[model samples]
Target: MADQDFDVVVVGSGAGALLGAIRAQEQGLKTLLVEKADLFGGTSALSGGGIWIPANYDQARAGVRDDLRTAFGYMLRCVRGMASEDRVLAYVETANTMAEYLRSIGVPYRCMPKYADYYPHIEGSMPGGRTMDPVDFNAARLGVDALETMRACPPGSKLFGRISINAFQAHSMLSREFKSRFQLIGMMLGYFLDYPWRRKTQRDRRLTGGQALIAGLLTAARKAGVQMWRNAPLRELVQDASGRVTGVVVEKDGRQLQIRARKGVLLGAGGFERNQAMREQYLTQPSRAEWTATPVGGNTGDAHRAGQAVGAQLHLMDWSWGAPTMDVPKEPAFRAIFVERSLPGCMVVNSRGERFLNESGPYPEFQQAMLADHARGNGSVPAWIVFDAGFRAQNPMGPLMPGSAVPDSKLRKSWLGKVYWKGETLDELAAQIGVDAAGLKDSARRMTEYARTGKDLDFDRGGNVFDRYYGDPRLKNPNLGPIEKGPFYAMQLWPGEIGTKGGLLTDRDARVLDTHGQVIPGLYCVGNNSASVMGPAYAGAGSTLGPAMTFAFRAVSDMLGRPLPLQHADWLEQPERAAQRPAERMAQAA
Candidate 1:
């Protein structure tokens, strides 16, 4: 009924949108954080929570070195002609600055000291990565009302209800170390204890990883007094006579509300990953909204459409941070095909029962190989992950976890089937999974040879350190384990994305630029809604997140006329000193 005006109006409630809102609020701007869905965090809540911030203080503090030239060399080698020099330079420069700023505002994170770069062979890459994610946050600190409204991590992604685990923990859960085993026992105890309570409460609140990342920000936002509204979809950009985006028109609670943004409207909403029409228009291949890893009704390009309506230029509109995924009836969403595909006893084969790319390659590179095969002849269009019973008993595949019996409800299918299959023999597995029986058997025979020799003459399955990260260290050739153990299995994989990385064209400061390369005042973009400064290359664990945060911080700084507040782990400086009482400290000094 009444026109609501604010200093800044942000669309989408992902990390980028929330970061902008938090910054705006901290800077004394009346900021509004809006999400189209009922949830607070969008795709960000579903992520692995790595932010690739090269040359960061966390790395330095951890005794891992990363410099400007090294980061520059990596970007130069990877990005190529995909993005502007200024944008890339700004990202590397401000990554550490942004990290410091967020810490000041109460966001916490630990450095991933051992996580290597995805493409470490490239120039200027650091084997020890610069990625970081939010440390664990307590949901009780955010209160029950806010916790209930936040999005929950998909069941397939979580190990124990809502109990989120980090990458190190994920890989080391069953480690041989006594401490690790003790921790594993503790984790299981916690899960069993909390699982019943979670069922009763109807909410998964033990946030970790990406969920923890957003939860930390939520805590910060609450402290900063930033107001948030869920289920508010942007309908149009409210532009002035001079073609300046002054505000936004959002449909909230079935009413059209015209909200004025005094400084600007930042479109950190998202890319077109969840919009089937846009995906079809931009992509040459067939992909649907259901195929995307983003939330069901979220990120349908409503914000991007509003920006486009106001003549905002879109760049690399069809790009995304893709991974191999398979959807099952048991899980509500497509589950990311993670470490399972690279285990010793596993092999990914096309329809002809032929091996394509290195099954143990980086997920994005694996995606390109799959797409290339599909584009050529649909060879990998419905590729199957062929593995043996030994593999099945040792590792998890997509929806199937280790040690859990394969669900028998819908297990059987014909030779031309799509989803999954299991058989007592390689030929039987091949026929049930729909691949050339001879081709599969012949490949299995050769794979057995390769497994013994620890050398794959064909695709080099376990060559790189990055590939080895997903494999078993116990094996001599971890990624080259034989598929001789029967009965074997086959599960199909589809190309899916963490999220799209292309949208509005923005400059170094994150100001949305037109086709003529002129900045449009009072308009900015970040996250996937803006063309990624890192371009098509996913360099490390948190490359997408790291730059998303950096660019969003830069955009906020422009809006507020000041750099973000610099905060550090102040308590870590002298923990015992902080614990001591103020009067007691004076007495002790005396």
Candidate 2:
């Protein structure tokens, strides 16, 4: 017997879970969203909040040219058959519609015209305008209590870990554009002027990045009257004799409760990145929980374990949304180095002091390069970003910030020996960081020469539009500048990820599939809980969240028995391996 009932029970409180709950509730279903931790918003709240939707309504309104066919072609090339063609097609075709739906529901997604695709050289890749970010939202709208309890954005995502700035502002400021100075001033003034909220919390009420995205979704969920439960850790799936998922057992208030779900259960609880044991069993070697930048409390594979117990097949468990993270002293979590690596006058090198990859490339590829080099016994697991005083003056390095804004004099004395290593000469820097001195000197000289010649002879650092997107525009090659200035520095970088990618495999409609590739009726998975739609490859900036929210929308639509979109209906209807109906499969087994 069930203790309580609802049309849907949503596990996890990230962007996808909240959006799914909202959609289900708005469609007249009694939806309940549950989170294991007391704090709402999983890794999604800690993310950059960029949503990549090709040919989105916002882009069209802004007169940016794009189409489904072009996006499909580009993604197909990027993933190289690692992902399902149907799934890829579903995302490309339905993404624009999903974006339109979000806007209708009050998610203010504004297109970022300069945010180029990670692989712009690929056929059908657009120069920019495929990615959109949620505009800054006032936290006061969600009320003081909600704002106080929400998971805060990471320090790397904010200005000095306090002030909020939009994605566009971050780009301009990081690139050190002339207009960015005034923009910063205006932002500081706006934040300080909010005197009433300032007294209550140091956190900026003007939310940006993942904070804003989750705030918007959380607001929608509340408005739709979705029942939200905190500290309710899902224990197991409840199924009837026929094997149809009907409810879930969750620990609430230190007691297990069986809640009946009339429609289905959504497992949106995030990946296993934070679980050290899971990391050892499934992921590539040399990975660690300490390396990940996800929130500290949860996302330890609760959904994956529960789904696997019921015969749900898992795929791509070894892959992740990899990024190089910097270890800041005394910080609870690592800070991912995203914008800093692309700036001029710096290079990432292995212990042998050899340049291994194009430092200015996309973050995932950057970490992949590290792991690949480490696999070859080059000791690239803890690589170092070698930079001179010139680079320090122009850019921020992890938590160090810019030298001009925060000089070495302002840095903590404790940080000098641990957070970073400083040297008056290249050889001295190499010695302090335990790298080959000769190799360091040679690499620095080569980079200096490349900056003067406007050509990266080795890795072609600024070869593409994507690489140059975050680079310094004042230089001949935005990604190349002389590293000859005295007083060099080195900071450690680990192959860290925002979240792991592997989990329960699902179909185009976001229905969980069993071992035999049949749908497990009344079960759906979204976000990091399911196998990523993009497969092993990352498409663009918002690749993770875009598919997450899109499929969440699709899951609710399928739950309501809504018809598939007409344009892609033909391909979608033709499943390569025909999935049997759940009841039919159960009867066959009997």
Candidate 3:
């Protein structure tokens, strides 16, 4: 007996949750979507909206060849025993299927051919074409009311905190290509000339990145007849006498409402990054809730708590989707330093003013190194990105745009001392940022020589193809440049994350697994609420959203009593065979 009944109860309004609801509703399940926040989209909307799907149709159409063997090999190396073999196999097998299914529902995506896999040197890694982004969506299609309520992307994802641009456009503009400059000009003109839409709302009609991805799925969900409820937070999971989940008690308004789901309750409500207690208890020390780039109060682990209360097992509690972040004036959460640290003419250093790891590597690896360095008593917790005026003139770092585009003179006064630290010399800049002056000067001199020689002698910054992806292509080594110009700048860097990677552990079909490794009937988990299929390592761009949606699709299939076919079932049956090295797996795949 319940106050409300639905075939499927989907908790959270992120991309994964919405996809599950849409799939269930379209299949005649009568799905109800719930969100804790009044706003619809979670961190997904505020993200860059990249999805890493190996062997996707978009890649094949573009003449990029990929196979399960290679993708699996790459995953095995990346996860390094952190993730289960079955889950990893399911991801490689069904990710493309998930993309195709979404495309059939009118949510098309474009392949980013130039966005290489995060670890190019690893076995089975592709130089490019594994990551893709949604085609820019027109939010106007959802109408004004829906658009207003939906979460908007953060200023970091937008151009000047207004105009939206896709990943391709971002790459082109960051590279400062001639055609992209013209395209930017045209885009600005189009945004301003949107007529009645502009007059009615300042929100850009064109949505890009995570907003575009969510908007497309949102539109499809609406068409599929999925009922949505905002400010409906899951209070607890209701299990019957047999220890089987039957429904969920959700808090709506000021009262609790029991919602029975005939099929299952899918928890995609994201991770516990916002929970300061959880962060200190699980994550590396020196972490803070305010350091996370996730929406404020959006991901306080409601789903995690709910799932845990019902005998669900948790894994990867010590990891997160790590990124180097910085504080900005009046911004609720920290702004991530994506692509900014990789650009030419800038290097991150500890308080002792020394480089510990390759600054141009994947962001997760970057933060991992930062934390490791800090653990080694190097005082790297609050590191700084030191750069020259030449670097500032050519590139954008965090909230500040390129000096050529928006000079320091035009900057908001509050941002100067807080967001940007400046000095006329290396020693002066080091002093201003509380860094070792001698070490800073030596590192800068060494970096300048490395820039000249087109090689990072100490750390090999631009040594890999992936490292050069977001770098300045105009230079000999896009990631190597001198910090020689006067008025050098430094910005404090924090070990910020998009979300926590730890949560309820689920099986290959996305069913919540209990402490004893048995599936808990009628309880499914996806998104950050579940332990990531990729484990502690980032596979590529869109790694977060790609697996989230793919597993959600699999979860829906399970809920409908028709599980998606598992790839290499015969191989997976034998535990001994599955434990073989990746080379053997690649041989079997061949």
TM-score of 2: 0.96
**Per-residue lDDT over 491-517 for candidate 1, one digit per residue giving the tens place of the 0 to 100 score:** 888887777877888877888877656
Question: Which consecutive 10 residues in model 2 have the weakest lDDT in total?
Answer: 577-586
Segments of candidate 1 deviating more than 4 angstroms: 160-162, 174-179, 193-205, 404-419, 562-590
lDDT of 3 by residue, 1-590 (tens): 89999989999999899989999998989999999898998999998878899988898677788888789889978987666787888899999899999899878887888889999888999988999889888887887888877898776667888888888888887777789979899889989889888887888998888888888888898888899999989999999999889899999989999999889999999999999988988999889999889999889988898888999988888989999999988778899888888888999899889988899899998889999999998888889899999999988999989999899999998786788899999888888888999888888999999999998988899999899888878788999989999999999999999998988988888999887778899999998999887877899999999999999999989988899877676545445643443335435544
Question: How should the candidates be ordered by TM-score, best one leading?
Answer: 3, 2, 1
Better candidate number, 1 or 3, judged by lDDT: 3
What tens digits encode model 2's per-residue C-alpha lDDT throughout 274-351? 999999999888989999988886879988999999989887798899999988877778988888888899998998
RMSD of 1: 10.4
Winner on lDDT between 2 and 3 is 3
- Estimated TM-score for each candidate: 0.91, 0.96, 0.96
Clashing residue pairs in candidate 3, if any?
50-542
CA deviation > 4 Å runs, candidate 3: 571-590
Q: Give the lDDT of residue 344 in candidate 1.
A: 82
